[model samples]
Target: MRISFSEWTKSGSPWVWLNAGAVAISIIMVVGLLALIAVRGLGHFWPADVIQADYEENGRQRTIIGELVEREMVPAPQLRGAGIEVPEGVEAMARDLIKVGNRDFGSADFIWAMDHFITHTQRPAMLFAAERLEWGNFYGYLREVKEAGQSVGRHTGYEKTQEYLTLWAEFQQRIDRVLDIREQILSIEKKDIGSINYEIERLRLKERSLDLEQSTDTAAYAKIEARRSELNAEYEQLQQRLTDLYQQINRDTFVAEIADGREVEIAVAKIVRAFLPNDMGLAAKIIHYAEKVWEFLSDEPREANTEGGIFPAIFGTVMMVILMSVLVTPFGVIAAVYLREYAKQGFITRLIRIAVNNLAGVPSIVYGVFGLGFFVYFLGGHIDDLFFPEAKPSPTFGTGGLMWASITLALLTVPVVIVATEEGLARIPRAVREGSLALGATKFETLWKVVLPMASPAMMTGVILAIARAAGEVAPLMLVGVVKLAPSLPLDTNYPYLHLDQKFMHLGFHIYDVGFQSPNVEAARPLVYATALLLVVVIALLNFSAIAIRNHLREKYKALEM
Candidate 1:
């Protein structure tokens, strides 16, 4: 207790405290970052109250209708630089960014106003925000509903209008009908007609194959023609149905009056949803939030990936990682087994081990370039030449796709697996191996049944680490398989259920594309955080599953180690 400061330092307690403090700080920083991401990402779905405000600008009061997005203090110099008139005594002025959702009015959807100039600001109960398919968002009052150019229902003041007889009610019914028909159109085009199109392509390829073979397959040609004729007939029938549906969906329109007193007639079909945020109750708001979150998780992104869901990206990320794991595990394990159990320990063996360890430290983009050059062009081109001669000129495997991406990642991560497995194999006591062999078990049997099973935990650890690294990788994926938007998912109900040749979307690439490449930065900011958070969660889930298996294996082999 009476130890001197020098003695205390010698006792290592100071160093321990230093380490503990550093660990605590690191944990705190990590938690804070995650919390920030969660808050920003999750808050986007909330039904924010829309304000109807009047602002004095250049001695004129103009009506502004939108949601208050943010508030900030701006120095007087900066404000003056922007040509804004600030009061003489003010060193700084407060500015508010308002989400004035009227992109159709030929100005930015977001506008900034000085707090001192904003005079009247109120959440108007009748002001509705319309979520549209094309024009981002529109904030206005529903003036009237029309069916075939005939006035159907007009909005009377809230108290006077019956619940079922309001223009909003008619708008809702027509929109619901439009949405239902839209679903039908999507199903026919994506599934039924998609299959027909796929078949047609296959037939074309088959005809090409016959031509290349120089075979007089007139019967085959006739059959292909008949099939094409049948498909054409079916397509024409579906085309008529699609035409009728489009007409019906477009028949209903609504007139909405903007803050500037201009009424725009919007086709009901263009609207995705409309809501009066101020009028929504707690339960209704919760439901709306849940629906939005679900849409974000399940729907395909639109609007340059600034709006809609990220299902394809999620699917691609998980699919590629799984495929990589499948490929890397066996090859890595075999290489590890050979090095650890069979290979003679020499200078060359040491060199190979050193090489592997160095490989892990190489830049991921280097792997991407190598994969593009070798796997896509060299290996894939050969495969196409041999197996897909009919599909000439069009690169199938000879392109950046799911297969090449997976293979590239597998090659990139295999070294980690090899090192972990070799270490695990080396940890097995020589007595245990000799004991198995003495009991009449062959070397392979002893290695398989005893050593490999015990090493499973370590192998799982390697795989988990690989997943953690590979999931967040965007650079290599861009050069290999990842794209801004994939027209079709790599997976489908086609002949080859898993189309390894197809380009895909990934959450990592999605974050990059949305965060930086989006045309609308204000709209895409929240989505970037949300997608990043989701990617973290996905990797965590994958690691957790691997960890669970590792734990089970460790437990099973606990007694053996003892």
Candidate 2:
């Protein structure tokens, strides 16, 4: 206890304890944040009981059927400010945020009601939560299945549910058929006819080129016209087929009775899912939760991204990071190698190093602006003119897209790689280099055979950091390539499988859009947390993979370091 400060410093135990404490605090903070995110995000998928509560508001009593989404206690002053009269001496008011999801019938899907005003609360076992195509979730009673405006099933009350279940099963079959037909239509329109149009355009461009060269031949023109006629005939056939498919899809309908006893006829094709949550047992609820999670992972977003999944965003984030890694690695390694191994250690080299270090500290948004100007406008415009002249007037590479976004991120992160690599090169023992040289190896050969391999772990470490930063970046991506909803994936079974010119969605941008830019803030909040959790997990996995590789390399080269 009486030890001198100098002695304590020399012992190094205090410093070690401080370092340990810092690491422990950091880990606790990270874990706590992740847990919070998981709780908010993952809970969104669980099946909750739908309560039919008789709520009295403004002296008017009405039945409200919806899921009890959340409960909160608000200050009495705040409630009074909102025109709600709180009792004398009351400090706060209890309120419930209910998701009364008859959006097509009501103007809003969510409502806030005073807890004390809610009475005659009942969890109806047969109340249905229908996820739809257009309006958000629908909470209602199943009236019966209908075909062409005629009822087909028994109107038995909630007790005799087997008839309703049969109708639901039949409705699901129709939905599947409609989905299949829609897929076929999409294939024809975007792929088959699209390819034909592309070919026709190619021919037209070729003819134009030939005319410009004064070599336009009658035979060539006739051949192109024949091909065009064939494409037109095929397109007509597809149009007729699509018309038939549309007619078939719109045939069946299901009638749902809302809380106000209004029967609404909803097309079977429009229903995404219909579930009776209160009737479900533990196993069924678990299964339903799993299905919802799967859909969230595998399906494309709809309804302003408040409904459905975010597969496109996930795919784009991964692909863009991979592209960035591929682009940044070589350039960073080359610059580092030259500066540390070949370039003379002069003021110029030091100045370059300083600039690189400063670049790392530069605001990422500045890089976004630079990328929009230099990469998207200047270089991409040039690429469009040189390579895709046929697609002029509309930008090909002359717009924000995958390649430019990847390159922009690569530029942003290359500094980390350069610094890590330089330090790694500096760490190689002098004797190792001399020994390589003594073996009659040239400087280049020695670097290739010994230095780079040993320094690779550091290179991987830099890449891991770069991936971690680039994957979660939103600002630059938004400016460069990310979109609210990408119509199609960048990779498709087209001429160029990976379409670098195509714009893509990113999870970071999705999170921002869902959390802030959404039209339905309450509905999108849980989604934001879930997406954030997923983004963290994805980055962690990527970093862990890189770390594993780095560890392996370090282990392999441990003897060399000694």
Candidate 3:
């Protein structure tokens, strides 16, 4: 079995290349997945053109190419002239006409028209405007118009025109005056306003003092009262002027009327027709679902979404991670110190090491079950009975919530920190501990001041790993704190705030909810992916921060090792 050197090298060379190729492929696949997620998530934030679809009363479709306009500009006369009949109960015909005609109107006017049209029709009308359409869809569009147009009685073209002309002229003049005043205000130094405010406060105090002395000293009160009167007058005048200026600005900026539904339809249809493809695929489906998720989040709180926003989930995750780290760190370090510094290398130590290793291998869901039974019901229930008998049979503390979740995860991660800390403690040279002991240092002092500092980096590494595992954990949290929806944040402006007893949403649960549990699974598919992507990002961020801290600690202790 004599093999030539050349043949041996050739056989080994292929295995080497094969291993290298496998590594390369694995890296590429992971990187590619991350890049795709980032692109999709970032793309969600970019602005898109709104597509509006307009359907005529006769079922004929017309696309509106321009922005929304006011009904006034698209007056009944103009529409009738354009061959469209003015329907009865069309309150703001002219305003609706303008909205249908002008495509360059602001977002506020556009939303107003869409809402008004939707209200009148009692049918869903799509408004394809920028999502950032300021003034919420409800009040921004409809409320302003209803308030502004209250003055003009219901009338057709001629009478309304006369009223508009009179109001417009007066309003424009007032607006101009206000603009001039604003300029003057802006030009005046900050010091001037401050001085005026200061003087007003001073005069107010003087007036109060004069009032108290009015019955005591007539001449003294008269002088103080006169000075107070002058100051009061100046302050009142300045306040009145500022108030007037603000009112004028509001009036000038106010949109009195909005476009009709037909106009919004037309605009949305046109935009949609241009961008949306006839054929949709997996990616499109995902995007559509993502939009639905966003809509759910942005919508006013409702029972359907259950989960209000992702804020509670994010907060719960952070709090649980922090608590777990705090709980595990000291215990792990102390246990590691005892094992490394004091305990003999005997059967008990070996058995404990084997138990720790086995604990790490246990299924996470099993830990969830254990936590629910032991911590939540047994230990926690007893504590709750003693301290909070009012919440009997379901103690607030014993409830499946953030606190129990953290404790459960802390238990799961203890072995990780213990193992790493023991390894780190072992790495500390025997000479260092021996030298400290020789210097009359107590064993605890030697372990703490000399040994622990050296092991900090490894302990940090363990904590980082624990956090990375805990953050993405869905199984353990499922029995603990994770909820489908939470009305308020875990921490809020309430008595004894930071309610760890409350169940909260998590990104992992959101993915599950959207994918399998949602009533509209079809609508929630893309949302599931988006949420999954977010969870991945959050876990990565936690790991990165831990790694950074570990590196810093490593560097600090590396000098000591030298």
Candidate 4:
């Protein structure tokens, strides 16, 4: 029998259990989602055994070599919809999604086949997988090693696996050297050359400015031209060095036999990693997994961001959040102080507070449009005309970039900060302010010295909330600064160090790009999970830092707060 409402209220057990159950369910849901993401995303790094299957397709018997990525049961109707015949009385058909990765040799890297059609399947110990710089992975049997188009060693049959492993060690050494040289060349081109180009542009602008002012400074032009000549000379030397490095890197190559018996010779420089997954021990597999994770974290994304790392996106996200917090904090705190301490309590103040609370609920996309129109086009165009007249016809600050993006987010999150800070100021004991005033302190002095310190913990809470919100923002950033791929970071070794006008990548946009816009869906799916997990972790870390600072401030002002 159900208990009476009055008795249940008196007991309080029902309400207590209800609240506990809600909390437990929430915790379970969050943990379960994280686990699902971790399993799917992190598993991509681990080595899986290579399977060789003999199957009949379109009345032809063929051998397929690849790794089994997934297995699923499909309804008979679904298979029939795709023009595949299903036998009578069969409810479902088992299918396998195999990663038969040789994109350069075929149209797609992943293949789906009906499991029932397979004649046989075996885990071959000799099958090899080579991760490359372009066109994804190549799974095959090792054929031969070559240098300058001359064969050094050849492998065939089951015995070839041991021979290939020996040569693979040598290839790894060559690959390491090539990667180092490539990195050096990239540094010279992007950093050194980029800096020179920037300086040249600055000089051009300066010369134009001088001409506009009608300055008769021959020595200034002479100095600028001399510096340009010096930079040009250095650039030429770097170009020669790059040429030599490229030639050296392209000297080695290797041949591999695909399942159909076609031999393809791939340049050693193009290979990122080569391994026999079927033969790897547990310890070796662990090392490989660690290496893959590091590459995902540190390397520049390739193959439409489905392959390699997301360092640029991670950097942009953190940088933008920091800029937003810097911009929003002071403005929010000052406005809050003015309203809570200095303002005359009236209808106008109440209206403003109401407007602010409403602003918090405004659609983020609307803010993005406002930012683009006002900050990017109108105000930015005016600033460009006034300050950067020498670079006319092309917009610098007149375009969507890091500064405007940060400013947009600042405006979006400032309402939260203001509301929180106002509440904090209201919580300061009236005795503290009166005590300061009695000691000959002015109103301003009392508020700054006595009231603000006591309210700082609450201010930190507001900032923490702002950071949590701003870091996950994608829509506004897309209209302002976020791009699918940014060639250079906003902050770099260029003049002024931080280029506020530069476009940047963000993790949120990257996830959207790889998950939806990528050409390879199966390959990008795991990356989406990985990137999503990473975004969560990044937000958590940022919040934790703010929370730590908040805790310290709260402790320091505990007595004052009381």
**Which of 3 and 4 is ahead in TM-score?**
4
lDDT by residue for model 1 over 28-135, one digit each (tens)?
999999999999998988999999888898989889999888899999999899999888899998999988878987498888889999888888788899888876
Instruction: Report the lDDT tens digits of candidate 2 across residue range 1-562.
Output: 5999889899998989999999999999999999999999999999999999998877889889998899999999999899887899999879999999878789898999899788789887778888888889988887777777776774657663677678767666766776787678778788887777767777787676567558758898888789888978987887888788778878888877888778888887777777888888999999999999999999999999999999999999999999999999999999999999999999999999999999999988999999999999999999978876766677889999999999999999999999999989999999999999999999999999899999999899889989998999999988899999998899977666898989999999999999989999999999999999999988998899889999999999988889
- Write candidate 3's Cα lDDT for 139-232 as tens digits: 1111111122243222223122555445444433544554465555543323344445546555555555556446566776677668767766
- Top-scoring candidate (TM-score): 1
The lDDT of each candidate is 0.91, 0.89, 0.60, 0.89
At residue 219, give the lDDT of candidate 4.
Answer: 99
Name model 2 segments beyond 4 Å from true: 1-12, 156-158, 161-215
Candidate 4: tens digits of C-alpha lDDT, residues 1-562:
8999899889998889999999999999999999999899989988888888998866889888898999999999999899887899999999999999999887688999899889999877778888888999889887777888888777777654567677767666777877887788788889888887888899888888788878889999898889989988988887888899889889888888887779898898888888888889999999999999999888889988989999999999999999999999999999999998888999999999999999999988888999999999998999999999888778989999999999999999999999999999998888888888999999988878888888888898999999999998889988987889899888887779999999999999999999889999999999999999999999999999989998998899898766
Could you tell me which residue pairs clash in candidate 4? none
Q: Candidate 1: worst 10 consecutive residues by lDDT?
A: 156-165
Clashing residue pairs in candidate 2 are none
Which has the higher TM-score value, candidate number 1 or candidate number 4?
1
